[model samples]
Target: MSVKGQYSATIVIGVCGVGKTSVGHALALALNADFIEADDYHSAENLKAMASGIPLSDEMRLPWLKTLAEAAEAARQKRPVVMACSALKRSYRDLLRDKIGKVQFVFLHGDRDMIADRLVKRADHFMPVSLLDSQIATLEPPTSQEDVIAVDVALPKTEIVDIVARTMRTRQNADMTALNSEH
Candidate 1:
C-alpha cells in the first residue's frame, strides 16, 4: 500500500522509558499526523498492576492490544497516525498489523542502564521503575521481516523524529514507485 503524503500510520515501540512517547509526539507533529498513546488505552486494572510494579501477562494485555489496534485502524482511515506503544513481542506487533494493514514501526532502542536511568527520573507515570527489567525481558527486537525502522534512543528527540519522518517518506516513495511500475 502507498502511504505517501498524510495517509500513513506508524507505531513507535520500545521498552518502558525508551522515549517512545516523546519521539512519537515529535514524529506526529513533524508528519502532521494524529498522535495516540497506547498506554492511554490500557484498562484500569492493567494500570493498577503496572503501578504496583507488577508486569502484565500476555493474556492480560490482549484486550489492550486489540483496543490500540482498533484505534490505529480508525485513525488511519482519515489521516496518518503515530502511536506510542510498548509492543515488546513479535506476536504483539503481529496482532496490531493483523488488525490494521501496512503499518510502519519505529523501534526506539537504548542501553538498559540508560533506559533504567530515564525510568528512575520519570515522575507521575503509572509504570514503575521496578518493572523496567520485566519490560526489557519481554522485548523482542524487530527483525528485518517486521518492516521496522530501529532508531537509537540516545539521540535528541527532535533528531529521532526527523530520522523517522525521513525514513517514512523514503519508504512511501519506494512503495509508490513499485506500485506504479506494476501497472
Candidate 2:
C-alpha cells in the first residue's frame, strides 16, 4: 500500500468533522509516511474564529495554505507525508499544487448530517458543529480530472484507509506505465 516511488506527499482534505485527521493518520501509517495535521498550522486568530462558529475568509486562509505547502515540501524531502487539511476549495488545492509539485489529494466525502453528528460528539476540538454549514457551503468537490481520489467517509476508517492505499497504488502504477510508454 505504500506509495514509495509514486508520490512524495498526499493531502487528506474534507469539510470539518469528516475525519480528516483520523483517516490521514491511518493513511500515513499505512503508507509509512509522515503525518501532519493542517489544523496545527492555523493561526490563533483562525482558531478563535472556528471555536466561535465563524468561518474563515479566503484572505485569512491563504497564508495558512502557503505555510502548509512549504511544510509539505519540507516533509517530502525525507519521506512521503500525509497532511490532513480542510482544503474546501479547488483554489486552495491549486495553490498547494503550485507550491509543491507531485502532490496527491484524498478527499473524504460525506453527508452534512453525518459529519455534523461526528462534530457534535467530538471533544477537545477547536472546530464547533455550527461551523459545519459554512465548511460545507464552501466546499467544491474535486472532479475526475483532478489529482484527487474521493473516498466515502461513512465507511469504516480501516476500510477507507485500505481503499485510499489501494487506489493510490493503482494510480501510481498507471502513471509509471504512462511515463514508461512516453519514454
Candidate 3:
C-alpha cells in the first residue's frame, strides 16, 4: 500500500447490512491504513430520515457523499484510507473518484435474503431494515471499467479482509510495474 505520497483510498461499498464496517476496519488494519466510517459523516437530517424509514433522495445524499470524499482526502494525507460507504450509485462513485484520485473499491455483494438476515440482527443503527430494498434497487454494481473488486458478503470477515488486502497488494504491484515501465 502507498503510505504517504501516493493517492490511495479504498471504499468498501454495499448495502447497509453487508458488514462494511467490519470488513473496512479489518482491511485498514491489514494495510496499516486509516479507517473512515462513512456513516459518521452523515448529517443529522439524513440520519433522521433514515431512522424514520424514509429513503434519502439523491439530492439529500449529495452533501453526505461530498463530506465523505473530503474526509477520505484528509485521512489520505497521512496514509491510505479504507472507508465504509454504501456508494450505491455509479454517479456517487464517479464523484468520489473525481474528488480523490486513484480511488479503489471493494463491493460486498450478496443475496437479499442473506443481507436481510444480517440486518435483522442489528439493533444499534439508525438505518431501518425496510430501506434495504431501496438501497439494493439503487445499487449500480461496479463494472470492469471501474477500479473495483467484488467480494461475496457470505464469506467470513477474516477471509474477506485477507482477500481484499491481497488484491490491493496485487493492484499496487501492477501499478508500480506500469509506472516503472513508463519510466
Candidate 4:
C-alpha cells in the first residue's frame, strides 16, 4: 500500500514476537498514517545487549520509552500516526498517554508457542528469538480504562489489521456518541 497521510495517533502494542511491526505497518497503510518503529529509539548499547539475549531493565528502557512517546506525539502534525511499541506494562503506557491525544492501542497477543515460533523464524533483527521468553515473561496486558483493541496474533496479517481497523472505527463512533451526550 502507498503511504498517504497520518491517522489518529495510536500505539500498536504487544509482547515480542507478536507481529507488532507487521500489523502496525498494515494498519498505518490502511489509515494513511505514518508509522514509527519504537525499537529505533533504543540505544546502541541496549540493542547490543538485546542482541546478546539480555533483557533491558525498566530503568534502562525509561529514557528510550520517553523518547518514543515524544517522537510519536511530535509526529502528529495534523495527521494520524501508528506507533509500534511493546508498552508491556501499564506504567509504560501511562508515560505515553499524555503525548498521544485520543490514543488507542492495538494489542496483539498470542500463546508462548506461537510467539516463539515467529521469533525463531524471524531474521535480520537485533532482537533474537532466544529473548522471546524474557519478553513474554515480562509482558503485562493492558487493563481496563485504556483505549485498547486486542487481536489474536495467530490471525493472518491482513486479518489482524482488518480487526484493528474495524475496532478502531467502532471506538471512534463510541467516542463521538459520548461527546454528543456530554453536550
Candidate 5:
C-alpha cells in the first residue's frame, strides 16, 4: 500500500491477509520504524470467536483496539512506528484518534476474490478463511478527511513496498529538512 508522505507514524489497515503485516514490516524496515501486529493483543475470547469463524462484535474489538493504541503511543515515543491493524471501522480508528493524532494511514484495499485468494494461501493464523466474509462486511474505507493513502492490493509486493517507502521517505525527509532550516 502507498502512504501519505510527511507523517511520523503510520498504521497499515486492511482486512486479514490483505498484506497488512507483510507490508507493514517492509515499510517499517524502510523507515527504520518499529512494527506491531494488532492481532498479537487479541483477547482469548476474540481469538475464540475468530477461530470459530464467528465474527467479533464492536464490544469485543474495543479493548483490543485500545491495546493497539497504547502500543502505538509507546512506539511513537521512540521512533516512527508502523502498526498493522485491521482498523475496519471508523469508530475503532476514532478510538485511537487522540493517542495518534496527525497519523497517516496506508489502506490496502481489494475485492472479495483477492482477499479469498490470499486467505487460501495464508496459513497458521488463528482467524480462519471462513471469517473473511464477515471481515469484509465490516470494513469501511478511509475517506478524504482521514489523511489516508489507498492502494489496490493487487500490486506486486516489491512494487507496493517501493511505492510506500519512497512516499514516506520523501515526506519525512522534507519535514526533517524543514526543521533543520528552522534550527
Candidate 6:
C-alpha cells in the first residue's frame, strides 16, 4: 500500500460533516501517506467566528489557506500527503495547487439532509451545523478539467478509502507507463 515515488498531494475536500476527516485518515493509511487536517490550520479568530455561527469572509480564509498550503508543501517534501480540507471554492483549490504542484482532490458530496443529520450527531467539532448552509452555498464544485474525483459521502469510509487508494495506484501505473514509453 505504500505509494513509493508517488509523492504528490492528495486532498480530501468537502463541506463540514461530509466525512472528510474520516475518509482522509483512512485514505492516508491506505496509501501509507502523511495526513494533514486543514482545520488545524484555522486561526483562533476564524474558529471563533464559525463557532458563533458566523461565516468567515474570503479575506479571513486566505491567510489560513496559505498557511495550510505551506504546511502541505513541507509535508510533500518528505512523503505523499493526504489532507482533509474544506476547499469550498475553486480559488482555494487553485491556491493549494499553485503552492504545491501535482495536487489531486477527492470531492465528497451528498444531499444536504444527509450532511445535516451527520452534523447533528458530530459532537466534537468546531464548525457549527448552522454554517453548513453557508458552506454549501459557497462551495464551487470542481469542474471536469480539474484533477479531481467526486465521491459520494453516503459511501462507507472504508469504501471511499479503497476507491481513492485504487485510483492512486492506477494513476501511478499509468504515469510510469507513459514515462517508460517516453524513453
Compared with the true structure, all predictions reach lDDT values of: 0.88, 0.89, 0.89, 0.82, 0.82, 0.88
For model 6 the local lDDT of residue 69 reads 88
Lowest-sum lDDT 10-residue window in model 6: 1-10
Per-residue CA lDDT of candidate 4, range 85-168, in tens? 998988888778765555788888988888888888888888887888788778888876887888888889999898888888
Model 3 per-residue lDDT tens digits across residues 18-86? 999999999989988999999999999999999999998999999999999899988898888999999
Model 6 over residues 1-183: C-alpha lDDT tens digits? 223335468999999999999999988888888999999999999999999999999999999999998999888888889999999999999898888877889999999999999999999888889999999999999997777888998888888888888887787788778878777
RMSD (Cα, Å) for all candidates, in order, is 1.8, 2.7, 2.3, 4.4, 3.8, 2.8
How well does candidate 3 score on lDDT at residue 24? Answer: 96
Task: Show model 3 residue runs off by greater than 4 Å.
Answer: 1-7
Residue 59, model 3: lDDT of 97
Clashing pairs in 4: 5-32, 6-33, 6-80, 7-80
True-structure lDDT of candidate 3: 0.89
**Better candidate number, 1 or 4, judged by lDDT:** 1
Estimate TM-scores for all models. 0.95, 0.95, 0.95, 0.92, 0.88, 0.94
In candidate 1, clashing pairs total 0
**Which 10 consecutive positions of candidate 5 have the poorest summed lDDT?**
1-10
lDDT value for model 5: 0.82
The residue-by-residue lDDT of candidate 2 on 3-71, one tens digit each, is: 424765799999999999999999999999999999999999999988898899999999999999899
Instruction: List pairs with backbone clashes in candidate 6.
Output: none
CA shift at 138, candidate 1, in angstroms?
A: 0.8
